[model samples]
Target: MSHLNVNFLGIPMASPVIGASGTVGFGLELADYVDLKKVGALSGKGLAPTPWMGNNGVRIAETTSGMLNCIGLENPGAPYFLEHYLPEVKKLPTIFIANMVGKSVEEYAECAAMLTVPGISALEVNISCPNVKVGGAAFGTNPKQAAAVTKAVKDASSLPVIVKLSPNVTDIVSIAKAVEDAGADAISLINTLLGISIDIRTRKPILGNITGGLSGPAIKPVALRMVWQVSKAVHIPVCGLGGVMTGTDVVEFMMAGASTVQVGTANLADPSAMGRIVNELDEWCDKNNVRDVNEIVGTLKA
Candidate 1:
């Protein structure tokens, strides 16, 4: 039998296919359509210290092969998650990761502390949100700020911390190395590339936020390249995500350097995507005579 099991930051996962945050909201809603246990893990929607109303107007728009989202990390805040969602998610037979975001270092740390309860398997620090205290610059864009946020969250969170990297950075390797140095247990890369769409006839922006994060098959190449680079640069494990839509794509990522992979846009396209990927991965491994999925990680010949 193919062994699909892998440990992410010491958190055991039956499979390496985790439901990306913002795509799988707390894992409860998806339970009806999917078998929660079949998924390796489910990351909660990005949460903040306080509830956010999110961006106004059209927050999502369709592009060629992907989609743009400026949802602004709309969430019910840390306390609500701990009280309402975490308990339900814990009942599921799958790993649970809390994706946390904030406008300031202190807020990130505070939310991390609040979400560090026993049920949470790990804390994923989302540095893609703008840092209002720092001139609205995204924490992940600056190596120094990324490191600072990682350090602060790591200090406050008892659970293992994973710093989610933004694709907007000029040097992803440098930022990945910085987080590694700041005590991040692992890293997830290529959150989403900034992009925009226009309605020519109306001569107006497609999304209310003007610019939004682009995700889908359109970004797979960039995500793979960054994952390969960051994986080689940092000692921590790298979870790759971009436009993965099939089992072949997951295998490609694992071979490139991803210890694990997240299914984001695919989930939006199909609620059963992650489960299907898991089953497909097993079949692929069996056909290839691969015994352990972990063996494929970072095995790229280069």
Candidate 2:
């Protein structure tokens, strides 16, 4: 039998396939489509200190191979999540990771500070949101800020913290190492690359915010490259995301050094994508005579 059990920052997952933040929305929406408990874990939507109305309309636009989103990280603030959503999400059988962000470094620490209360399995510090006006780039684009933000959250929260990395930087590996040195338990990288799409007919942007993050098959190559480089650069576990659509894709990420892989746009294409991918991974592992999935980590000979 395939040993599907995997540990990310000490959180045990039945498999390494987690539902990416913003896509899974706290694990409630997909309960009707598939039993979320069967997957590895669920990363909740971006949570701020206060509820946000998010960006204007035209928030989502479909491209030939991908999608642009200007959702602006719209979400109910942190306190409400701890009081309400956490209770509901806690009832589920899967591991729960709170993905959070804010305008300043203190906000990120504050959001993570109280995560030890209950219902949250771990904290995924969201430093990669490109649509926001402040801290997204503040923490992600620069190595010093990234490490400083990670240190703040790590000092505030007892819960394991995973700093999500942005791809819109010069040296992603440097930022990854910074987070590791700052005491982040793990790192999740390749958050949607900053991008925009314009409608030539109207000569206006397709997304409501005029600019958004690009996700889907278009980002796979870039994501894989970063994951490969960052994995080798740091000692902490790396969770990879970006354009993963098949069991083969997850395997590639794992081989390239992803301790776990999260599904974002792929889940948007099919709500049951995580479940199907889990099943596919199981079959592949069995056929290949692989025992522990960890055996594949950092095996990318290329």
Candidate 3:
């Protein structure tokens, strides 16, 4: 098999495929089904400064090619994770990235600081959370707010920060550049697009939150476009994710300028998705005569 290793934000990964946050459940949950060493990295579910109950009603609903979720970033608070999950996570052979979520700039920074332990390789900051100080506007929808949150996290945590940008923005490049300029070590784009699904029989929204983030093959095209655009605009590495399911999808994202890609909903569909994707990616590289996966980054042609 061709070399599938990659360096993401200065951390060496066995493969370019990482388990997306909110799907992998702290990295160890898939231990029984997946050979953790074969996968690149595992991004734990999103964690806040305090525990979150998530949504009340239906938290998930299946769509045509994807699914909608309003899980509300549910997770045990950062303190609990550090005390309980981090110990076992440190023993894993692969890299571990902590996903941090917050309702305010301070909460984000606090969570970042709290998770800055010896085990974690980096912090993936989810700026999609509603900024309570700004009337519930998502922090990622505004370039300035995104930059502010990036700066705050940078100030609090010594770990490399990867700001996950929301796809609901008008100009994704602006938001990407803003975080890069504000000292973000890297950026992950196209966090699930905002969507809604309604139950025709009941005449009510399928998700308790009414609207939820959509993820699956349906959003792949939009994700590739944004990753290509942002990679061209910023010097920092772009981690592309939205509807990645197979090795071909991983290759497509990397060609469009993503240094790494995260597998989200695919994990929900298959417990061993990341490992299978890594194998497929290796096969693709070997068949294509590509020696290193890095050779394909930003290789997209006009």
Candidate 4:
């Protein structure tokens, strides 16, 4: 049998596939269609200090190959998560990584400080969420701010810190280095580039927020490039995610410098996509006569 097992950011994953934040809706929701334990890990929707109702009407808008999201981080807030979701999800066999965002450095550190549970595997500092009106991208777009927030969260948490990065920046590698210097155990990118589409007739945008982060097949190439750039820029593990849909996409990410890849919009098309991708990964590696999966991680072909 092909080896599909791997370790991601110090957490032992059953495989190399993980569900991106906001796609799985807090693990408990996706427990019916697929077994959460089979996945590499689960990153919940970006959580904030307070619960968000999200933007008004029409949270999702379709594009040529991908989609735009105006979901605005509509989560149950930190207190609710620590009280309601965390305790219950901790029992599941899957690795639990909380995806978090902050309006201020202190706020980011505060949430990290409070999460003292042994069940959660790590802290994913989401400095790149484009679905909100505050803090996520602003902190991520600048290399300096990214480092500051990363260090803040690192100082507060005992769990390994994985900084989620934004693709809307000038130089992604610079930002990658910044976070690594701040003590990120691993880095994940690129979180949906800022994009928008207008309603032709009304001359208004399709999403209520007028703009959103685009994710799906359309952004895969760009993501692969960034992952390749950032992985070489820092020694930390890079978890690449953009428009990953199949085994080929996963392999591409691995070769381009991803230690792991997260499947996002693909899940919206098919819930069992992650499982199928894992199966395909084994066959692909076996056919190529690859002995160890990690051999290809960050081994970009010239």
Candidate 5:
């Protein structure tokens, strides 16, 4: 067997596979299907300072090799999570990261401050959210706005901050650099790509929000390219996500420069996906004579 342990953003993880936000649902939901201890970490669903009802109507639509969702970041609010979920989260052996989302910079800071309690290891700030104060444009699309949000959360929380970046932008490196310069401890990318599915017969959009974030196997190439680019541009560790499915996929991302990887859409297909991917990664390392998984990080040949 090979060593799969990793120290990501100062948090010691047994593996490098983290449960992507919005897909894992607080980590406890998959307890029956997976041994959560084997996984590196779990990023709970995106939480706001207050509860959000999320989108209505058809919120999800299937695509060729992926899915589209406009779930609208619905959650029971941070107070509820801290009161009802934190106790259970503390019981889990692995690290628990709170994924924060907000409509404004202050809201993001507020959410970060609220989740600074025990049991949560870090904060993954979702900059993909719209900045309602800025005409509803996504904060991740603008370099300055992304930095402002990063700075706000960094000042608000004592825990490490990992700003999650959106892939809808033209120059992802600029946004990554901005967040890093603003004191982000680490970074995770690329958040789901903006996409839409159509109901051909109905002659209308398929999702309730008319468009949604796309994820799954189809985005893997684009994700790897971005990860390779941003990792080279920023000094902080990069946690890659998008279309990671199997153990080999994890290795690919690591070689492209991700220190750790997150499994999103795959978990929806197989609840035990993270655990299985961990085992597969171990097997690959052993077969390839790789002693430690970290050795492969950013080892990509020109």
Candidate 6:
């Protein structure tokens, strides 16, 4: 098997294949089905300064080539995660990343500070949350607001911060550059595209939140383009996700300049997606005569 090891923001990963946040549910949930050790890292569900029950009514809806989710960052809050979740997560051999989201800059900083535990390898700041301080626009949509959030979280946490940028922005490159300049250690792009689904019969929305973030193969192309663009504009490592369902998709993301790729919606369809992707990536590398996976990163011509 070809070597699939990757150094993601100074954290050693056995493979670049990771279980994306919101899909993996803290590494241990899928441990029974897939060998967690074989995977590179597990991005836990979005956590806030306080626990949330999530949005009421329909939380998920199916689409043509994707799915919409309005889970609303439902979790037991940061304190519970540090006390309970972190201990068990520590038992897993792979790297552990805590996905942090907040309603404001202070909450974001608080969450980041709380997640600075020994077992956690990194912090993935979900900039998709609304910036209550700046009306309702997402912190990631504006470069200044995004930088403010990044600076706040970076100041609070000793662990490397990976800011997850939203694809909803008008110009993703600007947001990526802003976060990078604000001291983000790494970047993860194409969080989810704003989408809507309505029931024709009842003349009503499908999701309780009326609008939800779309994921799956439908957004892969857009995600790829943004990852390629941002990777060129920034110096930090880029982690790519969106509609990744196969090993070939993993190869494509890496070729486009992603240091690593995350498995999101695919986990909902197939529990073994991450492990399968890791194996498939190794096979693809060997067949292509590539000895190291890192060689494929940013290898795109022109």
Computed on alpha carbons, the lDDT of every model, listed in order, comes to: 0.91, 0.86, 0.93, 0.85, 0.95, 0.92
lDDT of 6 by residue, 48-93 (tens): 9999788898989999899999998899999988888888999988
Candidate number that wins on lDDT, 5 or 6: 5
Across 200-273, the per-residue lDDT of candidate 4 in tens digits comes to 99989888888898999999999999998988889999999999999889999999989888999998989888
Residue 153 CA displacement from its true place in model 6, Å: 0.8
Give the local distance difference test score of model 2: 0.86
Clash count, one per candidate:
0, 1, 0, 0, 0, 1
The sequence of per-residue lDDT tens digits that candidate 1 reaches over residues 124-189 is 889998899989899999999999999999899789998999999889999999999999999998
Clashing residue pairs, backbone N/CA/C < 3 A, model 5: none
lDDT of 2 at 231: 92
Structure candidate 1, residue pairs in collision: none
Mind giving the per-residue lDDT tens digits that candidate 3 earns over 198-234? 8899999989899999999999999999999999999
Candidate 5 on 1-302: residue-level lDDT in tens? 33899999889999999999999999889989988888999999999999999999899999999999999999999999999988998888788999999999999999999999878899999999889999989999999999999999999999999999999999999999999999999999989999989999999999989999999999999999999999999899999998999999999999999999999999999999998999999999999999999999999997
In model 5, what is the error at residue 107, expressed in angstroms?
Answer: 0.7
* Model 6 residue 14 distance off true place after TM-score fit, in angstroms: 0.4
For candidate 5, the lDDT comes to 0.95
* Candidate 2 lDDT tens digits, 174-203: 899888999989999889887889899999
Candidate 5: misplaced stretches above 4 Å? none
Cα TM-score of candidate 2: 0.95
Error of 4 at 228 (Å): 0.6
Query: Which residue ranges in model 6 land beyond 4 Å of their true spot?
Result: none
Residue pair clashes in candidate 4: none
Q: Score every model by TM-score.
A: 0.98, 0.95, 0.99, 0.94, 0.99, 0.98
User: Poorest 10 consecutive residues of model 3 by lDDT?
Assistant: 1-10
